[model samples]
Target: MRTLITIVAFLSFGLLSEIQAQEKHEILSPQEFCDKMKSDDVQIIDVRTPKEYKNGHIKNSTLINFFDDDFKEQLSKLPEDKKILVYCRSGNRSGKASEILENLGYKNIYDLKGGMLLWEKAKTDCY
Candidate 1:
């Protein structure tokens, strides 16, 4: 029947969209990422080495070294209810870190697309 076919098609499209969304990490540009981080409740993280973090970092982000021996444990401490925003020097480590967080049950993660390099290039204010 025509109604049956329409129902099936609609269901299929909905399921496909859900799958695509579930597999995606929100990759944000420097300006976009900074704009999103303006939300006071968001969890901002700097997933870089301590030395790199010490040199300069986002104003409100927490420092959780992705290379630390207990990196997984450190990440586990964050509450899943909040949105997590992560960045590294050049986005490579942050990409991997985002995957790790997803595996650990984090439902929301926003990764900086080109990391601090792009952030600085954009001339966005940073502290």
Candidate 2:
């Protein structure tokens, strides 16, 4: 009976921690994402290809090209201690990018919910 009680308590504590951990990774709206982008000390990764990125992208964003076969491996090299903000043309690829970040054990991950599409809609300044 004592063992059962301890096991249940441990399981509940673990679940609670997982729920809190999920909140650390966020999908930001265009406005919120843009606002956050203005801040310093974040690694903003644009997961679009070079051609797509050459067309337009958030100023100062680092290009990682999610379609690259090495996308997962390359992303894993990023410092896990730094916060990451990711985006792509329409948000789909960026969503996948954020998942990669999560799998890589990055602590803080933020993705633009609608990517550049919504960022332009919000009239956020960009290069």
Best by TM-score, which number? 1
TM-score of 2: 0.78
lDDT of 2 by residue, 1-127 (tens): 9999999999999999998777556999887787777777688999999998999888888999888889899998887767799999989998888877887778778999888888878865543
Judged by lDDT, which candidate is best?
1
Supply the global lDDT for candidate 1. Answer: 0.89
What TM-score would you give candidate 1 relative to the actual structure? Answer: 0.81
What number of clashing residue pairs does each candidate have, in the order they appear?
0, 0
In model 2, which runs have C-alpha deviations exceeding 4 angstroms? 1-24, 125-127
Backbone clashes counted, model 2? 0
Error of 1 at 25 (Å): 2.0
| RMSD (Cα, Å) of model 2 | 4.2
| Residue 116 in candidate 1, Cα distance off native in Å | 0.7
lDDT by residue for model 1 (1-127), tens: 9999999999999999998878646899988898888886689999999899999888888999988999999999998788899999999999999988988988779999999888878966543
